[model samples]
Target chain A: MAHLAMATGFLLILIGAWGALTNRNLLRMIVAFTIADTGVNLVIIAVGYMRGRTAPIIDGAVSAADAVTRIIDPVPQALVLTAIVIGVGVTALMLAYTYRLFEKKRSLDIRDYTDLKG
Target chain B: MIKRFIALALVVAVGSVFATLLFGYTPDADLNLTARYYAERTAADLGAANIVTAIVVTYRGLDTLGEVTVLFLSASIVGLVLAKGTHAPHRTPVPVGELLTTGTRFLVPLILLLGVYVFVNGHLTPGGGFQGGAIIASGILLLLLADPLKHFSHSLISAIESLAGIFYVMIGLAGLFLAGGFLDNRILPLGTLGNLASAGAIPLIYSLIGLKVGAEFASILAALSETEEL
Candidate 1:
């Protein structure tokens, strides 16, 4: 399951990168970047998964004494939680930029805004 | 066509590299030293049933604080950049259906309750402030959809945001003065391990985080929606 998730994450990132690089629409590229962010989050979370292990939450089922053997890594989950929120923040910022760009140029196409291109 | 081919080639190369890395990865048979330490010590040290919460709210609390700052900064910048665009001509407000408006009015409180529950129980459960904050934002989003012309009071939102942020920093400072270190959960005595109040400052910090994050997201949503659709 972990391997499958990793593969899926890698595939998503590739597809997102391709879309972002080749697509001319600024909004579409932002969406693609978000997809890639999701992929990265998935990959980070999957790296912590271990077979035959439960979550790190200690309930009646998983005792503290046996938690070291039973629980999966907690660090990655914490890191990924931060990463996911940061991803949303970045995506929102990018979207704001996209909206401002559209407001100025009245165009969504990246090719239309070549003022910064050398 | 040439651009498409080049993009595909780049993707293929990157995918192959990741694939190789993925194939070589083997799930560790045992927890590493740090993981082992956290697993063994978390309950005794923080009295938090949720190890992830222990790690997030205490062990690496500074990073979490920085993450919240990043979110706040982004939301603020989004609001700032899009603030000028609202001066453009306003579109005629579309009336939402009666059912949708009523349903949203009915559901918003419940969603708010759920968000509060998730963050309040951050020390004992899988969900935390981040997830709960997003939920609250979704509730605000529903309200926005139901009333296109409804103005969310910016003062109220900013008040909640700033208060929660100030309280969070205060708690961190208090920890520095009274406890082991900055953002230490030990400032308050750890209650029973599985209880709602077990994790001392974890629940408090998470709840503060929830409020700040929810307010930030609502601010962003309001900023985005306030813009004139071009």
Candidate 2:
């Protein structure tokens, strides 16, 4: 089931890549990029999940032996969180630049804004 | 049309071959234990349950500091680009909706609270400084969108950012004196595990990161909003 979710996430990333590549609208392209980035983060978090494993928290009643068996891996969760933040930063920066580009060109289409085209 | 078709076919064929090769290969049985070892040691020595937080803010704090510097640099470049050349005269104000303004007025505080919560619980949960900082940045962006007239005090944001940057470096240097390595966690007393006071230097460093990222992002958003400039 987890593998299926991961595969679906990967599929979404591919679809997002396609959307980004084919789309001429700058806003749509940015949205596609965000979708791909989110898909990557989802895949990472899914990889960290283990069947029947509990969250990595220590309980007072749980014995030391039980703790080892029940705790899920938390590294990927941390990594995903980090990746999500980085994605936000990049997305925001991209949007800002896109806005600036739109301001100068008065259009959101990428092909129309090429002043340096030879 | 023929050239485009050939290029598409080549891309599909190469992608399929790579996917097939990846599927055929099995990863090694040995688990990547290095991160785990660092996590466990951090949890024990620093008394933090969220091993990931300890690793990010303590064991690998230098990297986080560098990441913040990169963000700062990016924001500087964006600001420079947005601020270049003479300002355009008599620019028309972009019309904003009342709904967005009213809605964001209520939402901004909640979003800021959640960002703080995420960072505060970082030592015990999945989130840490960077995630929470970015959340705070989004809140600032919301404010910027909702109220373009309400300008952010750039001086205040710059002061906070500069202070945080200096403090981060100072903390790393202090670690050298206390623990013989930059960003060493032994400088502060590691409290009991699962407690708020745990993770010696992790929370401190994370807090600094949060401040730095928040300020940097707010400045970037502000710079981006100015259409009359550049």
TM, chain A, every candidate: 0.97, 0.89
Q: Chain B, TM-score, each prediction?
A: 0.96, 0.87
Residues B1-230, candidate 2, lDDT per residue (tens digit)? Answer: 56546655654664575456435534322224654464345555767776667667776667677677778887877777677554445555567898998999999999999888878777776677787888898999898788665567778989999998998899899999988599887788878777777767777877788888888888888777654643
Give every prediction's interface RMSD: 0.9, 4.1
Highest TM-score model number: 1
Best by DockQ: 1
| Candidate 2 residue B208 C-alpha distance from true site, Å | 1.3
**RMSD list, candidates in order:** 1.2, 3.6
Calculate candidate 1's fnat.
Answer: 0.94
The DockQ score of candidate 2 comes to 0.30
lDDT of 1 by residue, B129-219 (tens): 8989999999999999998666788889999999999999999999999999999988988999999978889999999999999999999
Clashes of each: 0, 0
How would the docking of model 2 be graded? Answer: acceptable
User: Per-residue lDDT for A34-113 in model 1, tens only?
Assistant: 89988998998898999999999999989989999999999899999999999999999999998888888899999899
Each candidate's fnat, listed in order, reads 0.94, 0.15
